[model samples]
Target: MDPKEIIARRVAKELSDGDLVNLGIGLPTLVANFIDPKIDVYLQSENGLIGLGPIPEKGQEDKNLTNAGGQYVTLKQGGMYFDSATSFGIIRGGHVNVTVLGALEVDSEGSLASWIIPKKLVPGMGGAMDLVVGAKKVIVATTHTNKGNPKIKTQCSLPLTAYKEVDLIVTELAVIEVKEDGLHLIERHPDTTIEEIINQTDAPLKYTNVKPMEVKS
Candidate 1:
């Protein structure tokens, strides 16, 4: 499978039945496509949606419904819609069980830098700050490197979204957990070598109890 799909599939494993999950834009949005049907998790959108489902077929698209990324989506049963104010309240109230988001850079300290690049223009922080802090747990889903530069760094060089707030990180090649001790290597992609991950990571990694990632597809 491709790297993006690999990362998304792995992250889907983290969701639990009946959990309320907030999926950020970009790669994080792909997680909605991989959620198991039997695992009843509510996929929330910052744009006032709850219980989002997989993308609809071309002819089945609904112009009135979309995710925070502005992509058309199907809603699961009991899905509810409200104004943006109510959505922010849900995020700020810590009612979300888990949040999957993408990051441009993440430090060993678990600080995330994603809203801007500074060198290039992009939209300012929307609801990312609130989601990272208010969610019970935050999981970063991103690639291991960007333009040959290691994204997992000793310290984030860009402006941070949250400091020491990330709970887990799932990349194309590894699954890392952020702990008080440091970044812990929990799972490695089957095709990627340990040395490759070591060479591509800027921060010191703890490999205690590390295991090969079990991806069914």
Candidate 2:
């Protein structure tokens, strides 16, 4: 299976019915496609709306409505749009149940560093700082490695979005639970060994009692 698909599936499995979730661009956006149809979850976009649907069929684009990812989406029944200020109020007021954001780096204390690749790769820090801090649960979804190096570190080397806002991280190779004290390596990839996962990470990480994250049989 594709690694991105695995990450998406793993993320989708964590969702509870009736959650008002804000999904960031990129990998966070993919979670919508993987959510079980039987499980009804409300998707909120930072652009001032809630109850977002997945991408529409080709030739059915709705120019007036788009997601934070800039993709056209259908609004589910009862979906509503407000001003951007109100939308941010909902996010900043902590009414959001969960937020799934893509991260460039996450530290032992659950700090996230996502914007800017350095040397001006991107301009401006977006809604990340708010989403990570405002949501009741902040979950980061990203690959374990970036350009063959561990993205989870002892300390973030880049600018931070929020300190200790991340509750958990789902990577291609492991699922890490972040606590106030430190990160707990709660689950590794099905084939991954604890030693292997540790060696790949640049920081010291403690392990939890939970087993690995796997595709349910």
Candidate 3:
């Protein structure tokens, strides 16, 4: 399986049956594709969707239906839509159970920096700030490195979306839990070594009940 698929599949395991999950754009959006069919997971799109389904088939996309990222999507049975105000209300009101987002940088303190890069032209900071603060749990789904540069850093040099808001970090190489002390390595990918993961991460990490990650075929 692809590395991103491996990460997404592993993240899918973090969901509970009744979770109202908000999946951020980019890599985080892929989590919907791997959720267990029997579980009652409600996917929430910040743009105004309540019961999001997986990506639509090639020709079956509803032009009017899209996620916060503007990707065409299908709706589950009882799906509903509302205005942006109500959508943010759901986020700000703390109704979301878990939120999975992609990060540009994460620190040992569990801080996330994903909204904007220094001087680059980019869109507004979407709902990340609100989601991180409002969601009961926050999970960051990102690769360990970007173009061979470690993204898990000793300190984020970029602007942070939230301070000490991340709960977990899932990468292609490992699953790390953010604790009061620091980032903890709880699960390692079956194909990688601890040394490799350590070498690829710039931040310090602690180990606890470390086990191999379960990747579904």
Candidate 4:
């Protein structure tokens, strides 16, 4: 499977039956496509929506409504729309159960840096910082590396969105849990070697409970 799909599928399994989840831009948004149809999770969009449904088929999309990333989406029955202020209030008030966000870098301490590169100009941080601190649980979905450079580092070089706020990290190669003790390696891609994961990650990893990644056929 493609790396982004691998990460998304893995994260999809982490959601509970009734969880309210917010998907950030990029790879994080892909998790919605992988959620099991039987599950009853509610997808929240920071752009002012709750109960977001799957992407509409072509010609069925509502251009007037979009997610925080501006991607067109369908709304599930009973879904509600409101102002952005209300959406953020739900986030800031700790109503969101989990949030999956794309990260440029996540350090050993679970610090996230995904807003900007500084060297290159990008859009300002919209609601990412708010989501990071507001969500009851945070999961970072990202590739292990970018252009062959390690994104899981000992320390983040970019500006941080939140300090040690991430709870879990799902990458193409490994599923890591950020603990008070250290970065714990919980699972790895079946086709990837432990040595390969270690070499590609700049941060030291604890493998006390490591296992092969579980992928449903």
Q: For model 1, how does the per-residue alpha-carbon lDDT over 1-217 read when each residue is reduced to its tens digit?
A: 8889999999999999989999888888888788877878988898989978778999999999998888899888899899989998999899999999999999899999989988795788999999998899999999999978999998999999999999999999999999998899999999988889999999999987779986764
The whole-model lDDT of each prediction reads 0.91, 0.86, 0.91, 0.91
Candidate 4: where is the Cα deviation over 4 Å?
Answer: none
Q: Give the TM-score of candidate 4.
A: 0.96
Model 4 lowest lDDT segment of ten = 208-217
Any idea what lDDT model 2 has? 0.86
Query: Could you tell me every candidate's TM-score relative to the true structure?
Result: 0.95, 0.95, 0.95, 0.96
Give stretches of model 1 more than 4 Å off.
none
Tens digit per residue, CA lDDT, model 3, 1-217: 7889998999999999999999999888888888988889999998899999878889998889999889898888999999999988999898999999999999989899998886894666889999998899999999989989999988898999999989999999999999998989999999999999999999888885789999883
lDDT (Cα, tens digit) per residue for candidate 4, span 1-217: 8999999999999999989999988888888888888979999999899989877889988888788888898898989999989999999999999999988999999899989888696778899999999999999999999989999998899999899999999999999999987699999999998889999999999997679997663
The positional error of residue 108 in candidate 4, measured at the CA in angstroms, is 0.8
Clashes of 3: 0
* Candidate 2 residue-wise lDDT, 71-150, digit = tens: 89889899999998999899999999999988889999888999877786775677888888899999999988897899
